[model samples]
Target: MLKNKNLIMIFREIKVGELVDFVNTVFYKNANIVPITPQRAISQANNPYAQPNDVALVLALNNKEEIIGFIGILPGKTMLTDERFFWNTCWWIDPEKGKIAAMPLFYSMLKITKSNLIFFDLTPHTASIVAKMGFMTNSITGTKVFLRFNLNQILPKKYAFLAILKPILKFFDSCLNTMFAKKSAKKELNYQVIKCFDASMEVFLSKFKPTMLTPFDNTFFTWISNYSWLTTQPNEFETAIAKKYYFSYITQSFVVELLKITHQNEFIGIVVVTCRDSEMKIPYCFFDDNATEKVLEAIFNYAYNKKITTITTFHPKIKEQLKLKKNTVLFTKQLVKHVGYPKQFETLGITNKLFQDGEGDAVFT
Candidate 1:
């Protein structure tokens, strides 16, 4: 619907400086728009296997000559829907700037991408405001923390950017892991690998809303948590097509024994981790507080064996506890929040109860 609607539209891939500038303006913070030195960026941008995110339609408003509002979109498969979608992801329109910045920018994006659904993450800070814009809670993706043993040994860029920040993260991951390890002793002692994709869909909603995390697109989140993906899809075409398109987005993380492990998989408690493909780069991994020390030991053991230098985790609690600096680079994939506020989730030929309550969907998505 956003078309030729006013504020002149300019579509282009976000230049690092431009994006950093916009982020600074909207968040009202001072930051350096440092060049992204991560090798991952190059993979998606240059590899044929890469399904790089689309950003050829960024909309920026200029009042006279001053830049005003902007919208950033990251494209992805609609959380649960089949059709391609262009999530309305991120928008920043300073009230004073008026619709000049908002209106045209939106229309321009609609004109460009071939998206059926669009969305934005509904974090605690932006929940109420997004809800007011006709958004509704859809699902809950818990943000968990994982304490790592070595900071410099796990992150990809530890030597470069985090050399100075390593000690802080090391201390943090250590303290939390110790605390969690103690608590694990009292946990229900239910580490039976409960079900190896076993015969159970037992999803126990956490009682203590750790981060007050909630989903704006509940169906999407729920479905993702359920029918998670693997290199193989139910159908051949879908699987082949997916891999062909998403190979880059899909990092080749080690598959258990494929990588080295020091600690045996006894009943150590597991931590929380977010593995979303966009927004932030690294997947989040928070450990069970009681089993934190074991986690660190295992992590260090793995590093030692594989000669792998570093790894990164985005678990908020762990990030804070470890004092890991924000990677500073964010990829905003556009998403359409829940299409309509459903009175009771009126399904329209959309039904997936397969993994209804198992595996937490955290590992698969």
Candidate 2:
């Protein structure tokens, strides 16, 4: 730890092996702020791509020894180039308390990684901040198709006072859904949702290696599924940590599953889906290009039966398919997500890279 001006102390590169101890000792239990939740810390410690000396996090603490700024780094490997990269998982700075520490925290990370970092889901403020840091920004188009009216959950997010009107909103939503109900001819499709991947799934993924940008294999998927960052069940310690943590730590319902899709007794594809609350996102989907219609039909049927509010995806092919099936959903909206990578990667053909919807830390939550 090094102390600087304004009496702030910086922990430059907290290694993966030390994450558990730092989260347990110097975090919420000892200070007023929590840098990382216990579950996330565990996931970081066991990250398959992380090495013992890899910098897992950078932290800034105030005079009171409370963490005021932090930037999490998850190590990654570029499958095609065989190069290592760091994904900026979460970057937060206390608005009222740590305004001055933001630059320090970010600078610390840049120094440690030498600008070999990639980040996504940038807010307007974060976008501007990163753009000024010599990082190149790119955009990917996604779609959020709503299959159900979710005003009860959506309204309160922007207007907190509407939280008390949940019962009325829920009633309105139910009435709208009933009005939009449909009965259509059934299609023949088979799928199995499993919590973990088996050897058969690994064999399925091996054939698509050339298309993947990240080094995603059975070990990587197993690490992700077994150690999800968001938990539906929170213990006392976790509950307390959630109150202070800046990022997602707990949810009403969270599930990550592997879907083995089969059509007509033949294996079609495998998909990784994460449903948090009523929203579902397809993080990774691998299927025969010609079988797009059948795979999408399977996904639509699953969402309809589960009463999922919306389905989101950034896959270009999937987005195009969703456009053709507008009648299957209540509504659809186009979304653009921003990604940041070091300007240095540009010389190495970064622009032509193919990124998955769940690349970096986008899927873990």
* Top-scoring candidate (TM-score): 2
Model 1 ranges with Cα > 4 A deviation? 1-55, 63-67, 78-82, 92-100, 110-115, 124-136, 141-365
lDDT of 2 at 70: 83
> Model 1 over residues 1-365: C-alpha lDDT tens digits?
22355544333345322442433353222211111112222221332211444552253534243335555443443224444444444555556653555656655555555423333344554455444544444542222222223343346344577767778876875675455322223222223322122112112123222322222122333333333233321354333333423122233342221111123544343322223221111222223555455554443333333333233443333334333322311111122222222222225222221111112222333
Highest-scoring model, lDDT = 2
* lDDT of candidate 2 at residue 89, scale 0 to 100: 84
Q: Note the Cα lDDT for every prediction shown.
A: 0.34, 0.81
Candidate 2 colliding pairs: none
Q: lDDT by residue for model 2 over 1-365, one digit each (tens)? A: 55656575656568899888877674448666676777888998898888988988887876676777888888888764656788888888888887777887788888877788888788877877899988898888999998889899999989999999999999999899789844332555477787666788779888887777786777878887878889798898788878887788888888777888888878888888888888999999988788888888878777776778899999888888888988877788999998888776678676766678889888888
Could you tell me the TM-score of candidate 2? Answer: 0.91
True-vs-predicted CA distance for residue 281, candidate 2, Å? 0.1
